[model samples]
Target: MSYLDPETSKKLVPIGRFMGEHFTGGNWTELGFLTGCDSIVQNHPRLLRSLSFGDDDYPEACLAVVGSMVRNDPDNLKLIEDYIIEHFSESGPNISTIPGLGPTIRFSPTVFKVPTHPQDAKLVAVMMPFGPSFAGVYEAIKSACSQTQWFYAQRADDIWKDTTIIQDVFDLIFRSQIVVCDYTGRNPNVFYEAGIAHTLGKTVIPITQNSADVPSDVMHHRYLTYLNNGEGLNHLTLTLAQRLRTLDPTLAQFA
Candidate 1:
């Protein structure tokens, strides 16, 4: 039996396609396992809530349904086990085997420490270089968001020489709640950072002075298009501020 119904499977086609295209070396079975868990969580909210609260039986019940989809693939079963364990910091889920029924897996809570950051720090990071052409655009964003108290910043203005540039970029992307990427001139570095932000599930707002600068693969995602002039910059600032408000209602007061 398929893990997902026809409608659910159809809904996941885009996710599967994106993962397959971007994560070339990823394990498809592991993806399927994760997808199955996600499906259950999305479709069966009550069951997921129970699992989240450390209900011992719920995970096993869900796994029974998931197992039916991949039971024939022992490799995938092991991969799923490993994936869960690794994700939960090496404390594996409870597992047992039943005669004629095969193996059963149950959810187990794991405690992991998360590093804390300074309070009220900037949550939005701009992924564009500092140059004459970008100066007006950057200032416009700052002005538009001034009332929200969001600290707008660029990588070059913040990162120090002691740390690796690539690492710093990754850290910034991971920490930021939103990433605004300017794809003007098709800068390779910006492209790479945008990809990282997408992979990390951060909201990336793409903007460009030239529409042609946006890559074909990413064109499907909405972006702000503007000319490299004062009028265009003003329009971008207003549009971007509106978009930010949509994401964070608190910014509405700033408007």
Candidate 2:
């Protein structure tokens, strides 16, 4: 939007720096001041100048001022965010998940036209061991996604872009809003991926077959337990669908 409210501005402020920093050769001086922000930028061009030529570690004071400009009238918020999506989607879509807003989530998608899912389905990234034994469990998760109508589930093996599997896993976790980590077998890979997901601030939903398998360090987070059998997996579908619906209320018509 050419203009944004304070709530939206609050969410955009933090990501603005990242957008500006990564838009490939983009300079902050070329940024368009919002409709009501011209005066501020005009009176203090130094802030813009500093951000444009500043080191990677932009001064907090400068960032605070830029944030104030955003709150004032982000007429340029749309322009800047569009550039973010364009550069981010150069190869189909660098960002795979739907953007969003709220206290519990990572992004505010109010104005940005994030292209990965024009359909608006919130992506649920799954971090699980890549073994045939867990195939039934993954299917249950996918079925749960179908129940939500607008949410879908995807695991790392579902997509392949880099020869290095870890890189693709990192990318998936980075783009997803909610991550489902399975600790069924106590696999080291799944545990490591879960750590990465938690560090990224993505809402993590931990599920496991045996509570004993959960690491002691992360036992604080509640987990869903389900046996990998027919009756148990069916129950898992209902539980997961309800959980996912609560996580993303925007498209959660079912909720």
Candidate 3:
């Protein structure tokens, strides 16, 4: 796609790569402000200086008032976010998986756009909980991975001691087509992240260990629940294969 400017590019595309994970956290409101501020200081230094107090009788009060106005003004935030979202493509996949998989079972999704043409097939992300629940779901994830080529990565935590990792996670989800969540533990962050992913129009795959962990809002939605054992692993794999068939016809071969 053609872009009119760098700002437009940042707003339109899902974050593919980043300097690090230290610049995450906050809502769109905060991101817009930061981007705007950075753009101004970098591109319009003279205008930025003009806003500050130097050799003037009005004191720093004038600059402080403008700062307050920018802070309290809803329009400013809206403008930035609108711009960001406007140029962005509303397509891609989302996977919600737990963090840190050493010798234990691990899962990740890796996605890339089909360069020659566009298709409806999506890049899916998987989110799972830690501990025994993940052990139970490990085979299921492996099955899912085998069926498709999804973008994969371990969730970033602290990025050079600068930003929260989820900020980057949100950035990734923005470009995704669907989100798969493993709610076996009823993790607060997983639930919260799933909400955000849903709000952004990502299709959500809500999986749980049992009915107890499933939220009432999503209880009505069909989900995959597996027991903890070798039998459970086999069942989960089969169930996931079937689900994949329904999601994408190409997945039928794998099923």
| Best-fitting candidate, scored by TM-score | 2
The candidate with the higher lDDT, 1 or 3, is 1
Go through the candidates in order and give each one's C-alpha lDDT. Answer: 0.57, 0.66, 0.47
Each candidate structure's count of clashing pairs: 0, 2, 24
Q: Per-residue lDDT tens digits of candidate 2, residues 7-29?
A: 54565755555644553223343
TM-score (C-alpha, index-matched) for candidate 3: 0.46
Cα deviation of 77, candidate 2, in Å: 13
| Cα lDDT tens digits for candidate 1, 1-255 | 323334333423433333223322133334554645445334644344544565555544454434443433323443444444344333333221100112333332232122133212256778886688788888877765663555455554676533456766665665676789999999999998888677555678899988899999999999998877889888987888878765552332233
Model 3 scores worst on lDDT over the 10 consecutive residues at: 16-25
Q: Candidate 3, overall lDDT?
A: 0.47
Q: What lDDT score is found at residue 163 in candidate 3?
A: 56
Q: Candidate 2 — which residues are off by over 4 angstroms?
A: 1-121, 251-255
Candidate 3 stretches with Cα past 4 Å from truth are: 1-122, 132-136, 148-162, 249-255
- Return whichever of 2 and 3 wins on TM-score: 2
Tens-place lDDT digits, model 3, residues 70-140: 34442342343333333332432212221111122222324322222222235455656656546547556
